[model samples]
Target chain A: MAKKRIVTTTLNGNQTEFLCEPRQTLLEVLRDNMDLTGTKEGCSNGNCGACTVILNGRPVDSCLVLAVEAEGATVRTIEGVATAAGLDPIQKAFLEGAALQCGICTPGFIMQSEWFLSQNPKPTEDEIRFNLAGNLCRCTGYDKIVRAVQDAATTWQDHYMKNCHEKGCH
Target chain B: MRDFEYEAPTTLAAAIELVAKHNGSARCLAGGTDLIDQVRVGRLTPDVLIDVKKIAELNVLEHGATGLRLGAAVPCYQVYGHCGIVSDYAALADSCRIIGGVQIQSRASVGGNLCNSGPAADSTPSLIVLGAVAVIAGPKGRREVAVEDFCTGPGKNVLQPSELLVELKFPARAANSGSHYRRFIPRNEMDIAVVGVGASVVLNDAKDKFVSARIALGAVAPTPLFAKAVGDALAGQPINDETIAKAATAARAIAVPIDDMRGTKEFRLHITGVLTERVLKAAVARARGEHVDCRIGH
Candidate 1:
């Protein structure tokens, strides 16, 4: 058998390393090897954004990426969305808006939304719908989810501008 | 997906050697969006997965005196995000944005799309109309294939097992020329194109007549087609609804669509005409300096 290689990456703002086979995807490494189960796996393929992660500032379906490809790259999962202080503004908005139901898709939604809102800051409803189309939510019917992202766009800009000052929340 | 030995060679010579060593058992990994999916579904099972992104030649995206040289591994987001491509290669920009959502676009490369050779691929038709050339590298050296003639059938192309696509080369934009790509899908996003059309038009100085034109159709044949008949019909034609309609009819005649879950043969045939007309009008408007969103053809 071929030896497993260690992939070194700045994961969730910290330097992390793990040994993984080339066959294992970044999704499997994060969940099975690292035990960061916060990033759920809905569909193992790229169709569901359940394994969404920000790789070098762009959101990607981690399941589509090989674990070995994460070498020397930066990645952010749902675990990186919040600090020790409290829930992120987007998470608060999700809570207030009841944006989730079964919750399997929430992590992916949060990761995707955080990256998107950070990019747009204030996106139109159409833009939000268009951007978040990749992250599928079987529950909530998407009304509250869309509303939550809209609210985050409006509400997070103040907190974002005050703290990060255009460096971006993520 | 089955286990496969991985190799990431940083140089073109080294990558070619590895591929040649593995022969038909090796597959080059560009964006891996399509390749990975196909592997998971057992469509392809390679003994060696060669990561070609580390190769400097395959990652180059530059517009210089010669033309636009797009690395085979250049992702869709970068193609759509490029100012040069957005303004000059509008068809490519339009096609890139429609590949998948931002995540897929973030990782999916147009070269990978062409190499996948799917008839439903959204980027192939645009590449065809843009007069892009596929640069392939093998153990024997390199060769160039016109993008229009790249594909042989669904999920098949001209490249041999050891050959890797280095990049796509597009000629300098023609004067007074504009291009656009659009597709019809069941939904707005995250769906394969049911019918797609890409059109580029070079208008006369007054912008009232067609100096020349190129049209390509997707999901309507065994491979994406360069609509030679349509382009020939539009050359020297007056820019009008009738001319566009005539081009549309010609496009439909050249299309050999098949029935599928995405659309019926009749439905695809009708859409071929409808999209051809719409895309040509959009291209004409762009040639006249109109701000047509690459996404407007939806």
Candidate 2:
């Protein structure tokens, strides 16, 4: 085993620290050391987006990232998608749209969709499909997932505008 | 994966020194999308991993009147998302946009792609057609190599043990000139190219004839090859279907593809001709001030 190095990062909304080997991947550190297992690992080679996480506002395959390399970065995983109020709009939309069957690929799909919708609030069907191509869902065949993203986009946009108007910022 | 000492050097000089000390047992990490995979699979066992992303010199992405200087560690998403790069360097943009899925694009760097030296790297043909030069830093000093001549064979390049690819510089395109890249893949996304073609054409003032041209092919040779005969034949010729077809035939003649699982040799040769024609037409359209959606998809 290599010498364990302490890495401090901003995970979700909290500043966190963990001791891990330099060779351990971000996915491994998140799962094993930090005990945040929402980010799943399907194919560790990065072909599948099952280990997706937003690092410093950009989504990346956590399995392909080293723990030491993310020493000072901010990371957001599936576990951070909701708040104390309730489930996020994306999670709500996924449930309403019935976007999962076996549910192994749901976390990654949701994380990726959140990143895409953050960039393009109102995306076309083709854009949604193309943007989410990295995530694979063998059970759902992707039709429901696509609809879920569309639904989330509309719901989230409406909610955002409503909040802005209530707060007198818009 | 093997355990190794990880060093994040803030300066290029320190990185070079670390590599020199480790010699054959060190690997530079910039966008570890590829290197991490190789290490996990036991293909690479470097005793020291030098993280070069912390080095300021390897993280620059600048565009000016002279041209563009893209730091070797700039991610693919950044390359494709830059306004000037997407508009002026269309072929490079096209390649960058489709290098991998969105996650991969956010992490993979074009410099890392070139250094990986894959035979079918999506960026090589476009870089070669754009006349890009790679700036390399080593223990001795610095040197520049044309992108076309950088790779010697599949998985092989001309970098010494203590050398690092610093950045890539591309000259500004001439007036009335445009470049485009296209690749044939079995699936629409997240698939390697079976046959890739990159074409850059500069039309005359009238937009009726080819003033100058360059074409490069990928996945059909050990190293991406320049279709010199095709470019030469198209130069000074009127822009028409007949001339384009002749150039496509010339492109087919120069391809030396092997029979791989992705495609057969005959299929690759035939698709090379098809893609050459399509890519040239698109480049010509762009040169004539026509809008073309060069993004990867149907």
- Among the numbered candidates, top TM-score falls to 1
Grade the docking of candidate 2: medium
**Residue pairs with backbone overlap in model 2:** none
lDDT of 2 by residue, B57-131 (tens): 889989888999999999999998898888788899999888889999998999999999988999999998888
lDDT of 1 at B142: 93
lDDT of 2 by residue, A50-150 (tens): 99999988889999999998899999999999899988888999999999998888999989987777677778998998899888888998999999999
Query: Positional deviation of B50 in candidate 2, in angstroms?
Result: 1.3
How do the residues A60-160 of candidate 1 rate in per-residue lDDT, one tens digit apiece? 99989999999999999998888999999999999999999999999999988888877777788888988887888888889899999989878778765
Q: State how far residue A134 of model 1 sits from its true place (Å).
A: 0.9
lDDT of 1 by residue, B188-242 (tens): 7889999999999999999999999999999999999999878978889899999
Each model's TM-score, in the order given?
Answer: 0.97, 0.97
lDDT of residue A68 for candidate 2? 92
